[model samples]
Target: MYKLYVRPGACSKAINVLLRDLDQKVEVIDARNLEGFKSISPTGAVPAMIDEQGNVFVEGVAIILHLLEKHNSAMLPKELLKKTDFIRWLTFANATMHPAYSRLFFLNSVVKDEAEKANTMKAAAAKVSEYWQIVEDKLNKQRYMGGDQINIVDVWLAVYAGWNAYFPVEVTIGPKAKAMIADVQAMPSFKAATESEKF
Candidate 1:
């Protein structure tokens, strides 16, 4: 059995959805109450996983990949080129888009000075908008980030996009993004993971 340490509605939602989608039997632990989360993850981030063997892994992208690899799901294309593209989009969402929004949302936390925080929020909002435009373009062309079928990349991106409702970011994907997210949420697996957890 694997134990997943997560904070509700955090980036960990992606991992939870994926695990349910794969139908894997893993214990879910709320990191908010779980002591030593920082000891497990120096950054004290949510969505950390500990295997039955006691090996621990942290980070949303890493955990998603680990679950996909462990399940040996056909959803993850085995071809090198396809896999590379999957990785590319995953990295873009995790490293680029996620951080950009973080900066925008946490402007005050990131910057001490009031004027600097306002400036940072302004710049970060533009960058976040640009990134969403890129996402909108890709999603408009393909049903999922990995083309037709839902894959790890799509799940990961959806998790970040889910935050749009909570945070004020101009998401131009419009109806398409909403529909795509609806499609994923409609999945039985996704429902199972999110039914008890607030998203």
Candidate 2:
């Protein structure tokens, strides 16, 4: 069994969902309730996993790829070009989209002046929306970023979309993007992860 450390509603939530989607048995530990979390993750971040072999993995993308590749999950493409595409979309979701949303959280905590904070968040939100538009346009051509099947990127974006509720920004996800998120969330594994996280 895999031991996954996660914070409720965090990007770690996506990892939890992916684990279940792969039909892996995972013991979910709430990082907030765990002592010495840094021992598991040096940065003290959630979504850290200790595989059955007792190897520890940190970073959301790394853990995700490790699990998918190890399990030979169909969500990961085997063809050379398709594999590259998988990595591309994975980076887009984790590096591009996730950071766009994080800007809102960073600005919210640091910007003290209400006006400046609001303005900063609004601009950050616009940036996030731009990323969403990219997803929307891509989804218009394909059922999912992974082509016909739901992949880790889809789950990642779905989890990230929920973070808008934690900020004061007006991030507008396009209709197709919203629909994609909804579909990803409706997955049995996604539902199980959300309930396990108490979200």
Candidate 3:
């Protein structure tokens, strides 16, 4: 009974996957038309959600956490070290990885000149590569970002990895990362949300 505002291939995919994984029924509104969302969330972001009780939720991390805590799901563990590690990857993906990709995707919006846009894109690609190196290293160590399970962090990770396709930056998922992506994709709900959006 949640209404999710989403545009195909946005980080809204994070909430899509979460809802699917939780087997929760939700109303998905295309964010290309934000009339429903703007009234709730000022930013009118795609990942915004309207809960069953009519309260609104926004942002990838906040929404993901809301579903986890509200549903008492194990995607985010209750332990100390695992929770910290889970939060570490989630923050790294959102705070660090997302910015570089957003810049690369919107380089033209920021830089007016064609020449400057090209230079800026190259610089943005480099930053994304640097961030990917960090991610690749971490995935090389574990089966999933949030620990052994393919949780919200893992779903968002797959979402971003696929989203990188929109930019010139290419992120080659390591073996373990590939496994996680494959696992998520294998889900009927995940495939329904993502298969058409793949680049």
Candidate topping lDDT: 2
What is the TM-score of candidate 2?
0.96
Tens-place lDDT digits, model 3, residues 14-64: 888788778898777777865555777787766888888888888888888
Instruction: Indicate the residue-level lDDT of 119 in model 3.
Output: 78
Tens-digit per-residue lDDT, 19-112, candidate 2: 8888899998889957888988989987899989999999988888888889988877889998888899999988999888878889989999
The segments of candidate 2 whose C-alpha lies over 4 angstroms from its true place after superposition are none
Whole-model lDDT values for every prediction: 0.75, 0.88, 0.76
lDDT of 1 by residue, 54-172 (tens): 98898877877877888898876799998888888889988998887677668645577877766666676777778877877888898877888877666666677767665433545
What is the Å distance of residue 99 in model 2 from its true position?
1.3
**Model 2 score (lDDT):** 0.88
Q: What's the distance in Å from true for residue 112, model 2?
A: 1.9
- TM-scores, all candidates, are 0.86, 0.96, 0.88
